[model samples]
Target: MSAARRRGSPAAGLCPAAIDRVRIRCPQDVRRAAEALHAIAMDHGMRAAPAHNIADKHTPVDAEGNNLAREVFGWSDRKAWCGNSRIALDSPITAACRFESEPFWVNAQGFRTSLPNHYLAAIDLANFEARAMTRAAIVVPVHLPFGQIGAVSFNPLDPALTELDDLFALQGDAFGVYARTFVASYEHVMGSLQALTAAARLSKREVECLRWAAIGKTDVEIGMILNRSRATVRFHVYNASVKLNAVNRSQTVFKAAQLGYISLAS
Candidate 1:
């Protein structure tokens, strides 16, 4: 079933009864909890993936066999019992691991598949070899557009809860809702955190000058356009370079552009 696009609207094809009984925990806390999720693994011997950013994962692996965390989510820090771990950006779990036990995220084109084994680490593994993890795991698939795939995994081996699929099936909607709300809150927190970081914030003039320099403009030319001396223009550019921690003017411009302090286009 397709997730409803309406903000604050819970996805359709969910149990109203389960939702009503379900209480969404602190979303701010939940989003922050993506870090140290290992505690959740330790708490119940079950791992939980709160948000999986697929954008960074849509690439080749690095030396450590992992991509930048931006692939799924960022600003991930452990708030409670969660930690830094994301699901496969393109994996079978996207569909096969839905709350409804149907394809969680699919379209007319095809299924978004990823490293299936990694995504389903906490999922059922009777057939595949089970790695030593917190005894159980619960995975809630959260699908967002713009190639954003979010899933919250929870494995609570609480003896009181058994019949894995049945129990998950029972609480699926609540989990889905929690996943939805948490993603929204997570984005907001990131925006704020980014703003809080201390770094030289460029003035409009400096930003424009830096952007123009990135296109191979000379200081004299840039100064003539801005009605400033080349020396003054160079100073601003140099200050920006320092803030960006670049070794040279070109590297400074590149780093500044990457951080989005200025545009690279001339």
Candidate 2:
């Protein structure tokens, strides 16, 4: 284990006071929590942005989509691509999402020379975006056991402000801890809030179709199970997808489960 792990999570005690002041029951609460995290990241001389895989799913396609997962909270000055760019497929932020543990940093030049070759291409892609944003970033991946995954990115306004070495030397452990705790709390409370609010947006039939779809039922199969016409089942599923702003069957199932309209569990 790294010293950070041996020493225990530094983020554990960093934000309790600020987090205690916010309620995660509403969108406003989420925003406030984000602000608190940003403030914490700033202590290390970098601005903070939070990105979520709101669907609670992560795949290359998920990052490649028009929306890079979802932008639950972010810095106003952050590059549009940082939150909504399809180019994220090759970005280091997406790469961080795949790490079992440990944080990753990417700068205008590239990822640290120590990163293995398999991780280089993604970091190369991230370097292009980093240059565009005039910043270098480090991401703290947040992987919750219940299928929620996300990250908090800390970026310096100017790539030259400090070397990646200094940033990591000074605040690496704090970044990991804060990102993990914040993302977990956000998902737990937001999951409940979405369950209540999102249900009202989906009709009973829509929910039924989505639940079935989540379990690997094809449209025709779903129709057969529900004794409805295939076209009818497709219609309900399409409507649910549209309501959730989902782009495909996989995303549709993911959104349904995230909002608590369906469960993909055994």
Candidate 3:
């Protein structure tokens, strides 16, 4: 069957031709998958960063200790991009990823997306190139389980090309599909920790309680809002905590936010 006909099948988002190239069943598959993605990106005048956890300071490497950033994209100084420092905290690209799940592009002016996000507009872009270290880029944000956000940036190999509006229009969707597939498969095979418990599913009531709790509603307040007794509200929250393997009410709410059951945004 054609790739489109195989939608929703195993490794659905990946192209049929790339399915075998990018499947990550072992450690070595990570590098193989990354190379497959790199070849596609280079065709569009871009370089790829296969996987990056926005919250992490260390650059992602293959299980064989190959720095994908350095080897794939030729970024020599890993520290300048990411390290035991606050670069992620200070990066506007990282800030944009927190609020956006779709693909977007950035330049010295600011972030550009299909939809207008006030949150992205609010970020400071005074030193855009200095912070992001690229004249411009098309970034795909991959929000994962446990609230982990990964990103793949396609930067123009040409230094003078600071705008990507036309290129984004032409190949953005293709890049989004490929980027998400590579990052998600890489994380599935290479991630060190299990991101969720088997019974982490929350019911509608549990989700409602956590959503209210995330906004700082006390149990009594949430009970009043939901028209349930205070004791009932407490029970649901506690049940959610048990399901999520969280220690306390706060962690329970946080985990729910991570799992996308609750939104932490104001």
Candidate 4:
């Protein structure tokens, strides 16, 4: 079926393919976006399931060691394989990011045998679990600055839907575009929210220091601008980093921007 015709499916309401641009701001929006991507896959005669994002490296595992996929996508009859697997650390989605810094596809066969050569034997047990749970996976890697890395993954559930190879060959670029756009929008909103929440605790002096830093001013230069001693400037910057949970000056500035506390353009 043609992409447009396939998108005519009612499920496409969750992921309207005709829309050229969108701003996804919440989980519901994400689900809609995911659904749309899945529709795109189906348009190419691929048997597909709902699309979902894998948890990033920063996401914490649960007490039972479950990742965000189970929670974010929520549980459904179609999601049994994911919930059964329970862990994300060595799953195919994560491996897609590990094996390459770019978007990639892994089929059932690749799931069974793909691994770093050095740990082939030692990692066999982990690989076995992944192979069993994930029959096929297409991961679109999103790499952002300051060590943020993640992916949007599509898992085909219906046994009848099995054109993954052909889908990748024909529509991979389109899939990557949708995945990248969604990931970027998600990160922007969440990062802003997190920064805003943390920025509330920042002192006035800290904000000043970070603003100057954002504009490329050095500690000594910032001191000159503020008529404070260099040591005092450094102290405020350090304190700001502490308050922002940032590891360094650059991160402090970046966090401040994320929170809308400072503008880099100025």
| CA lDDT of every candidate | 0.46, 0.60, 0.78, 0.54
For residue 90, what is the lDDT in candidate 4? 52
**Model 2 lDDT tens row, 1-266:** 12222323444334556555332454446655566676676666677665555233331111113222133233332454444445345455555456535666665655542234354444444345543353567767776643566766777856566457656645666677667666666666554343224334889999999888887889999999999999999999888888877788788788878777799887
Q: Give the Cα RMSD of candidate 4.
A: 10.1
Predicted candidate 1 versus true structure: per-residue lDDT over 130-241, tens digit per residue: 2212233445554543224555555453634422443344444445565555444444443123322364576777788887787788999999888999999999988877
On TM-score, the leading prediction is: 3
lDDT per residue for candidate 3 within 23-126, as digits (tens), equals: 67778777777788888888788887645587777666788788877876666674346432676788788888998998888898777786777788888888
**Regions of candidate 3 where Cα sits further than 4 Å from its true position:** 1-15, 78-80, 201-240, 260-266
Please, what are the lDDT tens digits per residue for candidate 4 over residues 1-266? 11111223332233344344434665446545444544555555433332223442233122333443344344343434444444445554554554454445555434222123332223333453244255565557677643456566655655444346554544455556666666666566444344324225777888888888887889899999999999999999988787777889998888777666777774
The deviation in Å at residue 238 for candidate 3 is: 5.4
Q: What's the lDDT for candidate 1?
A: 0.46
The local distance difference test score of model 2 is: 0.60
Q: What is the C-alpha RMSD of each candidate to the true structure, in Å?
A: 12.1, 9.0, 6.3, 10.1
Better of 3 and 4 by TM-score: 3
Ranking by TM-score: 3, 2, 4, 1
Give the 10-residue window scoring lowest on summed lDDT in candidate 4. 1-10
